[model samples]
Target: MRLYNRDWTRREIEERVGRIDQIGGIQRVRGAEGVEDGVELVRIRTGAGLSFDVIPSRGLDIGMSEFGGVPVGWLAPGGVAHPAYYDAQGEEWLRTAAGGLLMTCGLMNVGNPSEDGGISYGLHGRVHHLPARHVGVEGSWDGDEYEMAVKGTVDETSIFGDHLRLTREIRSRLGENVIRIRDKVENVGYTRAAHMLLYHFNFGFPLMDEHTKIDFPEATLSPREADMQVDGYDSWQSPEKGYDERVYYHRNIRSEDRASVRIRNDRFPAPSGAALPISVELSWDAATLPNLIQWKMPGQGTHVLGLEPANCVVEGRAAERERGTLVFLEPGESRHYELELKVNPGVTAP
Candidate 1:
């Protein structure tokens, strides 16, 4: 039975393979006792229960996500940190912010930390602690369905400066709970490259407490603090212990061309109740992510909620190049980003 060198005759080494039923697959974990201990995860089990954790070093974000067993995201207790402890400056990347489910902030810069011509950006960029080259994992069997993915390529170079390149792809199926992300940000170098991206998506504790609810489409919630107080942007709060985090900026109302957002938790009773309520959807493409940030942290163990999808406007990178809305990338040009994360269990809410 020759496998790697090719030739295998004897009726092809007594061929009789037949055991294809895999509903899901892709496992290549390491350290931290099962998935985080110096980080290097890739555990994606779809089978139907839906699982996640693909931190190819780091830039391949997405740290935690589960379905039937609960906990749809949010991890940051400093859980998955290895990227050699990344810390470009200012807030120290929230001390290895692993508040995941998907956190791929930017390619060059995104949100708060200013300084431009003199260079000083920090606080959301660095492409989530960059690292991810090659890193692959693909599974197939489409006739009966059972697709799986996880590809990578992050590269935000800098010698003379800025050379960008990020080709990520994370898909899933096989009793799908859904999670498809495809990015491609090239500008392989020569000039023109400002590009900023965001896709934070974080939620915790039974999909966030206090009867979570947030379904926006006809937006315009702005309130990044101008004496902030939007009166419960979408309502949710219960983890108090010194809470103080609120940043909203949705501006949707596109009316068409794909753009959805939801985060319901009717009462959170899935498993035993046999799929009760529990929702989560964030489809995208309003002409390539048109900005929507809303990170309201309730506090306590830092309960999370940060469904951000952006292309710019977290106000850094010189205030997005003085509000011209900074988003360059042309020197070979390349930009494409599609995201979808649905996990509806017995859905509700028309």
Candidate 2:
């Protein structure tokens, strides 16, 4: 297995993005087309008996998100919007500029068409859709399932390359609910692009109800002190709400690997008719990647929770380092990041 890198030598990954034609002749329901969004979706059943709803959010060129469901969490749009929902306006700066205020951006629709409204900010990270050229696939397939790899790149002009190189490949195997997301990022320029932040990964779906429960081990969490609730509509905002009006910032975080965190998702509350979902895990075994974020926002209007696994924590990469949690890479240096979504279904009538 040759470890791929982030550099000009990388191939175009976009060529590989397409529908999965299963050998078993499994049928999938094509998602309704959104006239303006130009989003394409394919439901693929991996050899492992697990399935996934894969959508190529056409416009945002180079990027994609995978989970058992679509659009995972709250991504403030890129340009502008309600103050509570997004940080819309921002400026570019690394060592000098203040943290970019991310607001609503070119929002993508996922989940049921009629009610699709969640947003992913950092505009899904500028890399999400960077006019990818597309590379070829590597990896083999067994009788049950197979693996395919794709690559893409983009160039940003500056005195220094201040440009970025990114790579993400997915592994779909049999008998596993987990799909592995492998990524690499290289700062190909001179000045450090610190003062950075990545919030684009957000997951929401069957778990977007008040009955949903979010659980994690947090013995050393320091809550973001706020006397008032940020959201007024959420019935979940009352003081009785366990996690309302506050963001738990955890230190002394424990994980199977420091590169990533273990598990984060909204589980169905008991007394519901909905089926139980398997566990989803995002692990970062590489450098560059740090902090595993689990954000549950049951504010009045919107209902969803986000399990964000970022290369750097909130306030961006520099902020994490300022607080003594993130690592820095030199020019041309890179880090390998991987995420595993273990979808273990519970026993049911066959």
Candidate 3:
């Protein structure tokens, strides 16, 4: 493992620290406050300055993240609310939607609030607030390399309804500044079920400033709202008061199996005294997540960017069915999705 400034053997690393945790490891903690009380979080530190919190009480989704003492994830004003506070009504999900590093949306629905057959669907979905079961965490050494992982299962099921089970695993290495999210959604019930999934990855503050650059995959882009299109649609702006959010959809991305987007900020200086930028890149299996959604909102106190990968668009479930883009899984069938996030402290700019 390469920690600090050079290579470290297992013996050398273990000898330096009385306990492995003295350098970096995983810890299970509970939120002890109003609304956030009883929330179980698995915090992992990669020793390489990458640390993040995974909420098992909230569908195994990731919360806050920081690298080199700098926060890269967006934390909403609502804090980390417990799953008990989730409301599935129209747009009510936003109330407890503690914006974090990654929020998993949907098992049955995604996007706009709509009703079908007298059943109402919420803003994003009910997955983010669903508690995970069979949670597991492990940090082991593979030869000289140290690998850490957290795994759990979250289900969005009800009586006579969809019985979708989502098994998620988040992995990272001791000296690596990268995290991978692996998920498999299965229809464990006896009936075929509709499935919609979207990974809402958010970035804010130091990572998303005025001069930040966003490099999206080459694709055909279209605005969600036709009239909201502007000249510099891909460029960001300074946070302005009362600014409206803009949504854009990217499709037909030109990539060989995997599609990615990079967000970079050059304001931070590196050890080499070069302004090479501190960047984060998200890449996923394009075959499963063929569409990308960009949520650009540079509003005062709400300055955050959400880059989402999904099988379905932001159109409601009903619209997805009407458009024939909704995915369905047969009984006992499963679908797998993989996504990786890499943080590069630009030793050499790309």
Clash number for candidate 3:
0
Per-residue alpha-carbon lDDT of model 2 for 86-201, expressed as tens digits? 22223221111111111101111111111111222232233333233353334344432345433444333345335555555555543344566565656676755432324334
Give the clash count for each candidate. 2, 42, 0
Please give, for residues 1-350, the per-residue lDDT of candidate 3 as tens digits: 99888999999999988988998988999999899999999999988878999999999999999887678989989988998998899999999998999999998999999685568889988999999999999989999998889999998999988799999999999989999999999999998888999999999987777778888998889999889865666567788989888999998877889999988788754434555468789999999999999999889888899999999888889999888888999999999999999998753154
Which of the two, 1 or 2, has more lDDT? Answer: 1
Instruction: After the best TM-score superposition of candidate 2, give how far the Cα of residue 221 lies from its true spot, in angstroms.
Output: 1.4
TM-score of each: 0.34, 0.57, 0.96
Candidate number achieving the greatest lDDT relative to the actual structure: 3
Cα error, residue 53 of model 2, in Å, equals 5.1
Off by over 4 Å in 3: 269-276, 347-350
Model 1 agreement with the true structure over 52-152: per-residue lDDT tens digits: 88888888888888886677888988778777777888768888777778888878788787678888878888888887988888776555455778898
- Candidate whose TM-score is highest: 3
TM-score of 1: 0.34
